[model samples]
Target: MTDQDDLLPIGLEDALPARAAAITRAMRAVLDTMDAHGYDRVRPPLIEFERSLAGRMQGVATRRMVRFTDPESLRTLALRGDMTVQVGRIAATGLAEAPRPLRLCYAGEVALLRADQLDPARQRLQMGAELIGSDAVSAASEAVLLAIASLEAAGLSDISVDFTLPDLVDVLADEALPLAADQRDAVRRELDTKDAGGLAAAGGQAYLPLLYATGPFAEAAAKLKALDAGGELASRIEGLEAIADRIGGRARITLDPTERHGFEYQSWFGFTIYAAGARNAIGRGGTYTIRGSEEAATGFSLYAEPLLEASGNAREAARDTLFLPLGHDTAIADRLRAIGWRTIAAIGESDDPRALGCSHRLEGSEALPV
Candidate 1:
């Protein structure tokens, strides 16, 4: 039986040895891939002033952040639920004068105050790269391609991207479909849930075509084009075409133009990426204007846990290990380690090399299979 004192809270747990190794390997691969692409890595503090944290991003829900009064500043400090906001702040303040289209990547643990029904964990590992100062089609394309590269480096295959227009409602409501002010929010809510009945109830029956304009990219994009009776969506449609062309055959592409579920602040374009074996999206990215600086940026955030799950390995194959018995030559062991051998020294003469996960026994200076 487990003791009450040893019980963990509902949404948190330790990653045992093997799992930790997998997460570490995945993190390294992702960060290295981003670095190779000239995305400088940044490490932001886990907690920041609640106001500063909340002020930098539009969709960041302060209610979902774990907050507490800081004894030193007497101001509220909040654990970050996302690192993209902090990256935005960095680009706006510290690197404000950096050249246009600054690139930054980060990996960190984020905690939420409460878990949602669909996603149970309140804490998760988020990794992302932000391209600051540009939300143009080229920037969007780069973000999408880089996201695929990073996930691929982390050992995921058969990745798919579902694209969205975060501001689809606002754009149509403004002119093309002209919705009443009171009906706008209801329409967005209904569409987010894919509820056709609720959409009509909310006075958005005119926008019903958007519901079916979701599927394979080629088909959905064509449907979306036909639905645009006016030329209001012409530019947006063209931009999507440009991005999809850039993607080529690298990933499976689909379009859900009105998907506003996890996207709170993306502007023209957004995407949720999924691996073949994952149940939910492993990453999401899009274009947005940074809140404080009002500068355009494109970025994506990927979760490590989902990446590991989709990769289907809690740990990788065991590496070749050498066991050193008592009184073994220390210098020889050092040489073996330097040459890529993993050495585990015996504590006693009776210690079994196989039990210690050592594939070879260090007999004298040579490693021989046990």
Candidate 2:
């Protein structure tokens, strides 16, 4: 019964009825949560000029996006790998004059030409809110809290947030510790690997203490503060504490100050949120400056695909479903439907109410149990 020609691409699959319903439910909850916070939802086109798409973020990799020459424009067009960049484009161009600290949220599909080792899917649903015009401690705090709220709204529980100072090295290298431009990347790489010897060999002996600065927020922040011999990281450390205080018992907090893995564009204050059953981060966000507009912003994006696993009520709920027999009154059926009953009209006498997935049957203007 299976046709070889009908096979889908490696990382793409059809979301059958049940799964599609769950995806819709999850996406609606996330968008509603953002709307409740006054963040307007935006729908951006799935394709854009490669140049425009890559110019918004400083280190965006346009090569990873699915690209082709547009016949009409005769220029390369790219399928977006991230929607945050599109939100930035909207804020800078369309909403340039729209008040400061503009709040916008979005939910859409993003595609990559090739799949990542960590996340095998080439296409995924990305939902997030961007707070344009500020990347201050307060903005960072709001972004973190809102992200946690969005996950909770989607029915995810037991969430934990891991914090990172995206610009930790640059901040320290500017004063407390010094490193040549070439040495900075090496130190960051070693720190990411947690290789103590590699860090020391890269002229980052002063950065060795940063290696131990991982774990609970309180303990890790203390270690980072103590290692700030010249007070280079004092402001960042305090900012982290202020944001953590606002998070307060909402979710578990941890710190990994030198984490730059998924934060190529994040300036500082990046966070990755995890849920109980998810094997990887469910969402990530941080503060960063838009490249073209040069505007400051803080935001987070939650991948809905992963949230599906951690959510308990992903299945469609049982409701009042009514079956209308072939000879049933159309007026009565309409009234039942208007009152919130789901109705399935029978086209033939052989149609069974139970077979049609109905819980009730229309009988003389009354909905009787099927």
Candidate 3:
């Protein structure tokens, strides 16, 4: 028989000592950056009533929630699969009477019923900031810029931002195409795969130019304008351009107008942040309407696990800790700690401070390099 101690459920694994410490430090750094930018920190519960958590949100997939019944109340409660929705609920009910454009930031562990092919872990550490009650292009711009800044503060550089219009399909559908559901799906598939020939064959010739509009900001913007997609589509493209202009020289910006997989609920501009050597998006954000209310908001959630992996140097460079010998004055250790040193005191006699992973040992009153 298999050993029970060695078994763990699929998509569940422990983040051992070094990795866990690194993840926490990286998250704290990003949160501190957000806090410095006037975004107040908020901590929502890990579980809430399913109705309140899922509540008619476009992007939240209710079926993927890990739900259970509360024993006392007998009401269905769900482990928060996504904090974005919870933030929206807080804004609508708890902070309903608060001022417009409330800025909030949060960080916590989210449990999902299943994992995507790209991200096999169902449990993940999520850190993000939400700008509620504003849908202006400026708000979107702020969200994107702040996301980039936060990642940089967390020791990630060479970041790239990919912008997308999640409602591009709806925008095209409103045109006089009159294609059936299946036909539209086919066109979307073509666009998603960047199959120019297939898209043209399926009455998507109007969108064919967007396939080539995938590159650096200026080039993509020029190609997009050349398409002359007037009305709302043109307005959306212009918003993207405005954001790119504001984000000048910070990091690389790219446009993928036809892509539409991740932003299920985003109505206008959506984006994904990428870093060199990271296999998945470091962060994602977009604009969406809060369910049960007319409030429009924009925000981004950064996945800490992949980001920690990408910042390999930061992960390995934990603070240098000093090991104190037994019978050493406690006041001495306190002074060392006050000066930003991590002091590990010896409880029993042990000469090998290196075994405890300490970089230095207390010799006399000073900490000498071991």
Pairs that clash in candidate 3: none
Error of 3 at 318 (Å): 5.9
Instruction: Output the number of the TM-score-best candidate.
Output: 1
Residue lDDT tens for model 2, 1-370: 5798799889988999888988898899889999999999999999999998898896678878899999999999999989999999999999999999899999999999989887779999999999999999999999999999988888888999999998888888866788999999999888878788999999999888888899999999998888888887788889999999999999999999988888978997899999898887889999999988999999999997779987853687777799888888888878778888889999888988897799998888888897
Q: Could you tell which candidate, 1 or 3, scores higher by TM-score?
A: 1
Residues 28-121, model 1: lDDT tens digits? 9999999999999999999999998899878788998999999999999999999999999899888999898899999999999998788889
> Which of 1 and 3 is ahead in lDDT?
1
lDDT of 3 by residue, 144-242 (tens): 999999989888888999998777767767663445566787788788888989998988886777688878878887787776545556788889989
List candidate 1 segments past 4 Å from native: none
Q: Looking at candidate 2, what is the lDDT of residue 67?
A: 98
User: Any runs in candidate 2 off by more than 4 Å, and if so which?
Assistant: none
- Per-model TM-score, in order, reads 0.97, 0.97, 0.91
Candidate 3 TM-score to native: 0.91
| Per-candidate count of clashing residue pairs (backbone under 3 Å) | 0, 0, 0
Question: Which 10 consecutive positions of candidate 3 have the poorest summed lDDT?
Answer: 172-181
Candidate 1 yields a Cα-based lDDT of: 0.93
Worst 10 residues of 2 by lDDT: 311-320
